[model samples]
Target chain A: MALRNASLSVNKGEILAIIGPSGAGKTTLLRLVNLLIQPTSGLILFNDVNTSGDDKHQRSLRRQMSLVLQYPALFDTTVFNNVALGLKIRGCPETVIKEKVDNMLAVVGLSGFEKRMVKTLSGGEAQRIALARALVTEPKLLLLDEPTSNLDPKNVSIIEDIVRAANTKSQVTVVLATHNLNQAKRLAQRVAFILDGEIVEEGASKEIFEQPKDERTATYVDGRMIY
Target chain B: MIYLGGWEEIGFGLFRALQLIFSGDPEVLRITLISLRVSGTATLLGAAIGIPVGASIALRRFPARTLLISVINTLMGLPPVVVGLFLYLMLSNFGPMGFLRLLYTPEAMVLAQLVLVAPITAGVTLSAVSNVDARLKEMAVSLGADPLQEVRIILREARLGLLTAVIVGFGSAISEVGAIMMVGGNLLGYTRALTTAIVLLTNQGAFTEAIALGIILLGLAFAINILLTYLQLRTKAGLFAAETERHHPVT
Candidate 1:
């Protein structure tokens, strides 16, 4: 996925929404920023430091960020175990893990779902559990790839509230990728329009949707056919 | 002993088979126990070695991986008699490492069956672990799991498939005849197992006794499969009452 001239900067403690149509490289951008995949040409900077490191270096950097995919790739286990896996890997104490997992589950409005098997959960419940797992780790940067795309309105609202709460309460930086223009407008402080693997326009959320400097951005924001 | 008409022979044999099973004939009991010990040991040993090896092979991406998998798959259908012959030569007095004189022993029988079962378990496990969703590993790595932890999670997700691998191995071990017969020599009250005993009884025209042993073998297979299936589903469904109650006490 060729990403060119996509030079984008995200300030700390703010939601930067990348809005684009399907196959427009939104997931790729998030993965690149998360450092899960290497960019062939561009440099990725996390916290103003060049992230050109070996595998060990990358893993340490990755521990500070969490990526929630469009579909929740939850493990086939109990909800508590799924939410507790990241902490367990970090070698957190059992008491601490239980405390944090419980808090996160409650945060996602899934209190007492600890023993419930993940296989028996509904889509919304599972996504909420996914959010719980991702947010439970308290990552410095939360990368969401269309988190609410497949969710019902109720789940969508709940998830949006959770993300907003995480940013507001923990001061977590967020890079959200979504195809829903309205969702981008609602959740993001800043919005960047991407098309064909290139960033067409970027500005404050209010400004970009209203007066996109690029023709493609304007066309997409107006819900028109853009080639 | 005299040969009888076909339908009446089958009828008499079946009646006597049931009689032997219910009456617990000493010879039948001894043969059944020997069969169980030999096959059970082989299956256990096979599972112990095969599961981890198979899981590790499935996770790796070495150059010889495809070739190794192909070899294992081919070995799954390895002829039992061939294994018996190979082991027979190896354990024979003139062959290398034959000084221990393990030929025609129950241990030799187990060795033969293990050869037959290990490949089956390993091949099935390889297929099972490979069939698990690839996204699971990505998720594990994303969540800070090192490579080892990634494998652990994959194995956990493929637990049912791994169990099936073991069950299939056990099935193979229990039903085998040619290899054990060749190496074990079908020694009465010694290495003679259900299949070998059935063969002996049939050859001697004790058809009813052979049929009895056949029914008992089928019964053993049925019982073991039912037990394993119960464990798999029960654990999966969280219905292990004792464990469940301890972990999740009623509120």
Candidate 2:
């Protein structure tokens, strides 16, 4: 029971941040949104349609979204191949794949790195590649689970900028689960604070951070709540 | 004087073996070619059958998986002579499979090697695939890969182990004399292989010829294994270098 009674909705083309103390089921919420795990008691509606379908339908729904984890988990291959994998999975043409991958790499500031092997990449570069790989497919939805927690300040700023641009320019809805409160306020317009597998506070970032309706949310927002 | 003479015989045999190999002595070449054909075919078939079974058993969860893996590991250490004797019985004139009449043929030798190699290849592949990071699968699925595509990624990641399995299988198939000798009949210019020929030469008291053939057999397996090992090491060196740099970054 990683998550319990967690009801959340992600508005399309908007960034929704899930902020909470550790073990508040941020990852479970993201996994549920990604359809990686089915909820036992609740229904997920994507585009006004229930996502409880057969395997093919489930796969189809999943393909429309992408998830980036705290750990990049890039393939043991060239950067080009790693970024090109999603486009390749969609069965895009070779020219289209090459063009898309190259453009995505450039967007992530890793231009001309097509021939570089992934194992040689630094932690930041690998995460950027992971982010590039996720965003390359132009997925309708992007679920990021603590995507920048392990990153240094420089890489974190680079990643946040990239995510913001992707959300604004591509109209890709973003659901970000993060332990960083400032990051949630910086990037997300609307934030949901989950505590103990439940969303205790859900509102605009300003309201949650300044005038939280719940005492727990205020303590958590004040950074005094210890796990 | 006798010990000195023994050393001279071994030195001369080594020299003669090199000459036979370099000059392509017709008999030596024939035996070598026959051995390669039998072992090569058997290893090819073994890789085809073993890699899939090994990879499937590693990635997928089902009932009796541990038992199946145990059975495969046990099969890997089966003695070549015992396998030969069993195969000889099965392919004999009055045996159940005797209707095919594959006895005493090169095909029979191939079948024997196939049996010995398949389990070895499968077992190695199973171990290798199981060692791949479990996070990779979840990453693949998160990137929109379906089950089949996810499997493709896993197989790609485990490519090195698969290569090792084939090389090991080929080594076993080419070196084993018992199974091929019994099933191939060790006929002159037809079924005769390096090991069988070496045995025949030694029995006929042709010590120099036997020694020469033995040296060539050992040299051939060593040369092929070295080549594959060099390729493996080259790739591994790159990975190790990168991993070391990641762990111990220079100031």
Candidate 3:
């Protein structure tokens, strides 16, 4: 019941935003792409290869992407270990893990926080750490679910900047899900409007916001779409 | 008539036990050491088997999982005498495992205690693992951790709870007398542990020696409890600190 007949694709290095009201299945759609959950009946093709066969192949495909949850879900360890987890799992050497983790922390404005316990971090700080952890692996695709839903303006702006930098500089494909229309306009190249588990309209971000083809999309962009 | 001079007798017995303790009574020390060794080995074996079983049950979903959990929970409170009897039958001369000739030996006592302890350890560990946030597991998977890596991460996060399980298993194994006495036969200078020895001394009218053994058992239990409790408190404090900071961020 969460999502049905929802199909979309992303270009390499392009940012796609999924905008919708609460219960519109934006999070569910993102989770499906990340392979955290499977569709009851659908095919997900990664790099033109169907991702629904063979456990080993699925795992290999999964390793090429990362997902950041709406709320930060950090390990109960130091910040360094959190960011180094993916690399370690992939059998990266310790020296490389340390260097990459350190650089990623610095990029997220958390320099010198390698030894800080994750539990002691503030919400914004924790979310930033989650981002750093996700991006440290340099995944081919990064899916975020309302990455800035509850953050303050300053933290929100900082996160937006980080996501932009990751897409432009690292060429990581990004799919961000949020209800914030302005955020979609600012960061996403293409936008999809989801309502009740279906994509109502999909187009370039500027066109979607400026001249929406669907009446519901226009009402949603105008901030008048009721739950 | 038998109860005459009860208070004075107990006071004198207490003083005598203390003297015996300080003077290094070989029999008492030997009994205490044997108790520790048997129970300690059983606890280690129990944890080795129990933690993984518990974690697997918690993480995997299959048919009869609820039934398995219920069975484990029931076994956690298994009567010591019943376990002793069950193992006695299995290890008896006419039984299938009789070729090992482990009956009435220290190993048999250890086996009995292991049976008791393993279920307690597993049940407690199951509860602990179940308490972990489901989102954490999802996040780990989303961050590219394979199934094995995901399990390792979950176990690491639940380390404190696992430690508690081991401690509880040890406590259960160390405190029981009936099961060990039945399987070990409480052989003098061999399998006689603190609990069995205390019973022997008390029955033989050596109240002073019994009281001394009792004091040592209490002291051991108290020490282990205190250490584990301190550790639990520290872990809880760290979690609480994180929770507070998360909810109330500094400007």
Q: Which numbered prediction scores highest in DockQ against the true structure?
A: 1
Model 2 chain B worst lDDT run, 10 consecutive residues: B242-251
Estimated TM-score for each candidate: 0.90, 0.92, 0.92
The positional error of residue B165 in candidate 3, measured at the CA in angstroms, is 0.8
Error of 2 at B51 (Å): 0.6
Q: Native contacts recovered, in order, as a fraction for each?
A: 0.34, 0.37, 0.40
Backbone clashes for every candidate come to 0, 0, 0
Please, what's the RMSD in Å of model 3? 5.8
Q: Compared with the true structure, what per-residue lDDT tens digits does model 3 show for residues B137-250?
A: 888777666677778778777878998999999999999998998889999889999999988888999887677678788888888779878887676434312321111111
Alpha-carbon DockQ of candidate 1: 0.33
Complex DockQ per candidate? 0.33, 0.23, 0.24
Displacement of the residue A194 alpha carbon in candidate 3, Å: 0.7
**Local error of candidate 1 at A52, Å?**
4.1
Once fitted onto the true fold, the runs of candidate 2 whose alpha carbons sit more than 4 angstroms away are: B2-9, B226-251
Residue-by-residue lDDT tens digits, candidate 2, A40-99: 887999877798877667777788888999999887778888888877777777788789
Rank the models by DockQ, top first. 1, 3, 2
Model 3 chain B scores worst on lDDT over the 10 consecutive residues at B242-251
TM-score (0 to 1) of chain B, per candidate? 0.90, 0.89, 0.86
